[model samples]
Target: MTKILGISAFYHDSAAAIIIDGKIIAAAQEERFSRKKHDPKYPYNAIEFVLNFAKVKLSEIDHIVFFEKPFLKFERILETYVAMAPRGFLQFSKAMPSWLREKLFQKKMLFNLLKKNDINFNEISKISFSEHHLSHAASAFFPSPFEEAIVLTADGVGEWATTTVAVGKKNSLKIKKEIHFPHSLGLLYSAFTYYTGFKVNSGEYKLMGLAPYGDPKYIDLIQKNLIHIKDDGSFRLNQDYFNYTTGLSMTNKKFHNLFGQNPRDSKKDKITQFHMDIASSIQKVTEDIMIKICRSLRKEFNIPNLCLAGGVALNCVANGKILKEKIFENIWIQPAAGDAGGSLGAALAFWYLELNKDREVTNKDRMNGSYLGPSFGNEEIKNKLNNLGAKFEILEEDVLIEKTADDLSKGNAVGWFQGRMEFGPRALGGRSILGDPRSSIMQKNLNLKVKYRESFRPFAPSILRDNVNDWFELNEDSPYMLLVANIKKEKQKQMTEDEKKLFGIEKLNIKRSEIPAVTHVDYSARIQTVSSDTNKKYYDLIKKFKDKTNCPVIVNTSFNVRGEPIVNTPEDAFNCFMGTELDNLVIGNCYLIKKYQNPALKKDYTKNFELD
Candidate 1:
């Protein structure tokens, strides 16, 4: 029963993960439970959930690993504030109290929290801290199906390094070069995200999504005014026009004046073409910088495979561009590329570096397909269905697959809850909203009817693993949906002159693929391939759907609507189904009919008594 617990807290996207004898048992982000976008408070709630889910006492844990060394990160923070003295005075002043109480005293904080959980730090034996990018590197590489590969991690700032290049072989990883902080590609994207009237960390994806709608009108502006790139693939920011260090925003008044407007305040103004163009320009800049860095990393490492992590790796747009160029023979991205994935990385680093465990790189990546969250057993699900007074059927395995496939083909959006929940941001089939993408109106229907999300947001395609190359331009695997790929020539729908002339986000209605709902305005799709080897249930269901409909892909989105985190428990899943227009929800073997759901018998539905 040897087990290790890895934790990432205080920093945003706080999470906890448990690995029992080298197998990932449980992992989840705090945001799912807390309902915060990036809950950064110590992952007390998440840790409790993981410990209870694994049914292990804290005393049974062999080791505890923190994601990043506190002192090292504190040093970076201090040095940065000192170097850019008085520039970020207001923010610095606001942050000082928290730093003193939380950051500087983290070791004591960790000790107290662990002690409170009845885990004797003395008997717990080993405790260690991983370098930030090292954790990111380990998270991507150790789980990848590669004996050796080039590793690249890029984020806003981790300690001093914003980006790092390394070579990972078997159980060992060696850092080759690191591009330090304040010159981060991520911050550049965030700065523009803020400038374009979107939240910094949360809004980067919106920018990426908006890129297809507008022209890259500010690419030259960003290149010339915002950043300075050297030949060595390192770049520096012209801090004068930025305010992240001191001011409330990533962009300053001068930056706004240069752009001919102040930052668009989201609470006040409507999103316009100007904002879209800015998002487009910044996203293109990010992709360009990433390509440049990838080229340099390839030349330096000369490895055929690449492992990508850090928060920016979640940018499916950039991941797609990198794939199109074929710089790396293969790529594997961390499903939780943000701070939450850091927990898994830190745990693996402890396993290999501290425990000195032997590593195995298999033909399939050692991720268990990222289904590391808590799952409902048949008993638990059946009890909930009975309690809710819902009519349901417990079908046999083959029957379940066939019926689910038939429902999907008929355009019923089913909440496919099976196995453990997913650990990452994306719902990788288990906690997913499933629909037939071949329906031309399915995208809008899912947006306005099923999921009740933004109309502009696109759904991701879950294709059978073997059919990746036939439908997409990609020859590589994307089991995590962290990478985007172009629709194959044969899969694309013919465009009329009217469709070609469609401008702005209105172009979203243009058909690009046999499955138009998942295809983006740019003719690319964030594709997740299902493999029976990893998740047999999801794989079999997709296979059955393809057998029935002859389409290898289906629409897969998180099982929750916009502004809410993905459903974390059976109750959450059921409540979301009842609130939204979801046609069906399967929990374990019990299929719940939302139409027959009785609200009074349930604890509560959050959507009730609320006006949108």
Candidate 2:
């Protein structure tokens, strides 16, 4: 048997993955184990978990692959600093120590880290590095249910390439073209994310969620000042407006002047019409750029299928727009499209590209529905809950599903934990907080009471796969919740002329659909279509919910408070359940009702986690 271990670390979303003979055995992110959001430390815990899951030792692995070439990335940073010359000395000084002490000698540092696993210096020589974009392309194409497809990857600078185009045919994949760094769609979006008073890497989605509440009034101004686009989607950043190349901050004074305001201090200022308009304008610009690129690529390749990976691919709004425009016959995206997925992609790159192995396609992708993380058994869950002195009831699978669905129907927020945890940023059904979609106050209650997040951000809908079309305009399988679709017109509640005249975030409270909890102000929803093939338990729960309420959809959000990582164990789930306003906790076949829990166990969970 050929065993390969892949590691992506020292960056946000550090992770580890193991593959046996080109088949994925296990994959997980370090944050899930560390209880830190986007933990960048070496993924020792994640690596240990994967090795144990695969029943292998580090010494037995044939190849250990790092997701990106560290030297190449360091070179890009150095050259960028040189280009900026004397203007960014402070930034250069701050960055140089880390590069000199750690990143510049990544090979040595990595070897030292491997020593902790009892792999000696000689054995550590087996390590290999893959190009950043190649890893991303392989992640997108190899696991997809496609024989041949066009792959596009765009992200904040990876080594030197920020965007790349590749084609995958059977077992072989080839890169066709690339747009190098200092100009990137991902960075552009992240810059706006910062400018709009949100965190950069983690706050982009918040910006996307806030877009539907405002008008795209700044689109023309943005197109004129920040980016220059050709007839095709290829574009150049003016550079004068962006400070990411040489400074710690994403945007500069020039950018602030162009936007006509300084960045918002999220803690002090309320989200007004200006920030909402900026968010909407940037979202529209991003969609336009993505659509233009997909159109150009389709005309060039004439391929029927398109595969997408990288952080930007996480923008379901853009993905939905591409689907609406019919840029390709079919689109498949890596559920874990961000840097966390680079571990899996790196391993797949070595298996397919380096070893030149044969390829096999399945009707459903080979991601195991992205549920490739650690799982706990009923005995283990029972022991943890007992140790915590928690109140709970154990029931059969059918009874558990029925009771949980009934609780949801009566307007209870449930922390639903089952099977293996998800490998990506999304919680899927494995670690999710579910609520009834028909409740008009469900969204607001979940946001302020349960999640403690900004009220303007929207929640996603988890719907039965067979009934997806009846609720939303989308007919495609969106198992990963990476696509947004409009609510079916028949299901929508048309707004009156007075309601239509409401501006900015004022439209937020106006109900737009039957499933108002999951519907955005613009009548679109980020949809997850559940299937029995991937998660039978979750599918059954939604089915039971439908039987009770005649609505097949439920509000689904990650199972944690704001700034906390998704709960990984029964203990984490119980803690999160007790911390928030969640009414119940369900793990395996056991259910714990909040009202029955000991009052002494209740603590202020808001103080437990740092806000992002």
Candidate 3:
């Protein structure tokens, strides 16, 4: 009956996770409830939700774990500033106030925050802190299917380690090696994200998405000037070209001079050929480093199974490269690989690593498909829709699936909200906007009309587990939608030389595969293989769609407009449905046709969220 609560906050993607006797009870991010993207405040809302969901009070919790040791992190920051002295004064001064006022005494602040939530001040003394990378490692390996595996975590920075290699066997994990801060691949990628006119942290994916549009023309220049890599994947940055350690911006004047241009002003600049090339170059470097690291790990440990966490692990493109290289026979990644997942990891680290509990492993993973967030019953949904004066119909599961499949086959975009919400960045069919993947116009239509995002941005596909290998080059399970793979050659459309010569984004509209909506310009698709064991309802709906259209894949994007967090409740889904060009909304067993809904319910959803 041991109940443990894990918290990660103050550094972005704040979240809370609870585990009962080593079983993950619930986990969620603050942004979903607060409606703030990457909310870094204390995860009070998320913590409260998990407690209620698990039907436990704070006093019942035997342990509470914070994701990282704040003092250790502060020490690292202080030492780095001292080492860089005189040179890092501005950044040091800018960071000191927060460190001194809040982070330096984070334990006291945490206790007060908990007391405000009605937890007894005495109970707060049970809290402990886990090292940052250890949390990442625990999150990756604990819920993974493997009983033994090599775990790799890479991020911008933790207390001191930015990257760590650990081995997990049964309930225990041992750190093998670590690469400390100021030498980080995650920061390297983020720096390019900044240089390419995209927001750091949030915009790293945009850079990865933009890579397919250009050649890796800057790879040599990047290797020679920006980063130095050895054969084993460990590398150092030429700090002369970077400012993240000492200034507000990621790149310095030396970097700008080397790149032959200043940073692109996101507000005024068009994504030019140069920007795309830079994106491509960095992506290539990232993939190369990841592959090299996996190769090194494989040769060193020869472990068939590998698990990954940390922010960089969210790079599906690099993950895809690791899979393609076959350095590891199997890879299991935490769906919430970013800081949000640290909460879960921290809790698990306490349960197994600290308490010495026996490990329980599962071939299907212990994440329960990462559907560990809030859900609404049909009665609640019906009431919400009825109160909104929205026109709707209700059906049983089978009929709803049939109707939704029929609508999808007819080229209608469906907002699918079912069961518990997902706990990570991906929608995973739980809170997804779906469309016909085979439609040549589906990509553009979903991007411009539905998501209101850039046309160049690609969508992902959720394929039935049985049909995944038939359509994609991947044969393994990818239930979490964290891996990218090429569309099978049989489904690809041959292109003419003139079509191939189309420069930059001109090639976007040229369909390269039958499932053009999900296929990127490079013929790769971010693949999510849905299994009935994890989510029977979603699996059945896709199964029905496949039976109707004979296409095994569907365009699966998050159930929100471009910049908004994924819809967390029935109300959020209903509002998004009314505001977007979606044809239908399906929540639990309730189905609503947009045309029948009150026209007045349609407000400008675009104005609801600020674009990232």
Candidate 4:
């Protein structure tokens, strides 16, 4: 058996993954264990976790692969600075010292870091490098169920390539086309995110959520001044309006002037109609570009399946638009499509491309529902709860599901920590905060009291796979919650003339559907279809809820407050339950109610972490 370790570090969302003979064994992110949001360190804790989980010594591993080529990235930076010389001196001078000292000699630095894991591990030749875009493409196509597919990857500049097209057949994958740096759709969307007073990488989703509340009033302005798109879906950015290449900020003075205002200060200024319209315009542009690209790719390749990866693919609204166009017979997106999934991709690329192995396609794909993180047994949960002075009661599996379903019917917010912790951004019932989807005020209450996020932010629905078509317009499987679709016509409530006339957040309180908690202001929902094969406990809980309320959907959000990483252990779960307004705590087979716990354990969670 060949044991290979893959690592992606020195970038946002550092992670580690281990594969044994082409089978994915373990994978996890460093932020979950370090308690930092988007931690970009060496992923020491993540490496330790994967090694321990696989019960293998680092010395015994046959190969170690880093996600990207550092020298290639350095070359892009040097060339970009030279092309815009004297204009980027400030940024160039600041970046030079780090590149010369550490990044330029990544192999030696990596060797030192590996020694910290095991002193006996000293094979420097075992370490190899994979290209950034190739890592992303492999992550998307290798795990998909399709025997052949066209792979599309787009993101903020990686090394030099920002967007790429690859074709994957059986075990062989090859890049066919490339769109290089300084012309990126991901960075374009992020520029709007920064202009709207939100953090760049972390707040792009917030911009997507705010799009439905406003009109696309700036689309023409954006098209004329910011980006130029061709009929074949190839595009370039007007650098005169942007500053990402040579400055610290994303947008420049020309960008602000064209938009008719300066960037909003998130600390002071409020989100008005102007900001909402900006978000709407950018979102529409992104979706249109994605659809055009998909159409062109299908027409050119004549492939029935398409796979997507990279940060831009995380835009579920764009993904839904592609699905609605029927450009391909099927679509598969990487669950961890960001920089974190690069670790897995690096490992898979070596197994199939480097070693020349045969690929075995599975009916359900090979990700195992992305439940590749740590899991605790009943005894571990019991011991940890006791040590934390948590008050709880243990129940049988059937009784536990029934009682949890009963609490949802009573409109109680629940902190559910079950089975294995999920590997990606979305919490697929593994570590989630669930509520009744039928409650009209559940969305508002959870946003303010529990998540402490913006009121306009939307929640996703976790519906049973068999009943997804009955409640939502989508008939395809969306286990990763990466696709957006509208609620069924029969389940929607028609808005009155007065309600329809209301603008901005004025329409927030009006119930738009039978499951108002999960429905966005535009009557659309980010959907997650739960199947018994992937997660039996979550499926059974929803089934029990359906038995009592005749509703097969529930509101599912990550089990964390704003700006914090999801909980990874029993103690983290207890602390979050005590800090937030969640009413019930269900970890493993143990259950705890807030009223039964000591009042002294309550905490001020609002200011616990920096807001994203």
Highest lDDT: which candidate? 4
Runs with alpha carbons beyond 4 Å of true place in candidate 4: none
Best by TM-score: 4
For 427-456, candidate 1 gives per-residue lDDT tens digits of: 998899999999888899988876665577
Per-residue lDDT of 354-434 in model 4, one digit per residue for the tens? 998899987787888999899999999999999999999999999999999999999999999998888878999999999
Candidates' RMSD to native: 2.4, 1.0, 1.0, 0.7
Q: What TM-score against the true fold does each predicted structure earn?
A: 0.95, 0.99, 0.99, 0.99
* Cα lDDT tens digits for candidate 2, 19-124: 9999998999999899999999999999999999999988888999999998999899889889898878889899889999999888888888977875543575
What lDDT score is found at residue 327 in candidate 2? 85
* Residue pairs in candidate 4 whose N, alpha carbon or C atoms collide under 3 angstroms: none
| Each prediction's whole-model lDDT (CA) | 0.83, 0.92, 0.92, 0.94
Q: Which prediction has more favorable lDDT, 1 or 4?
A: 4
lDDT-better candidate, 2 vs 4: 4
Tens-place lDDT digits, model 3, residues 354-462: 8999997767799999999999899999998888787788998889999999999999999999999999899998999999999999999999999998888989999
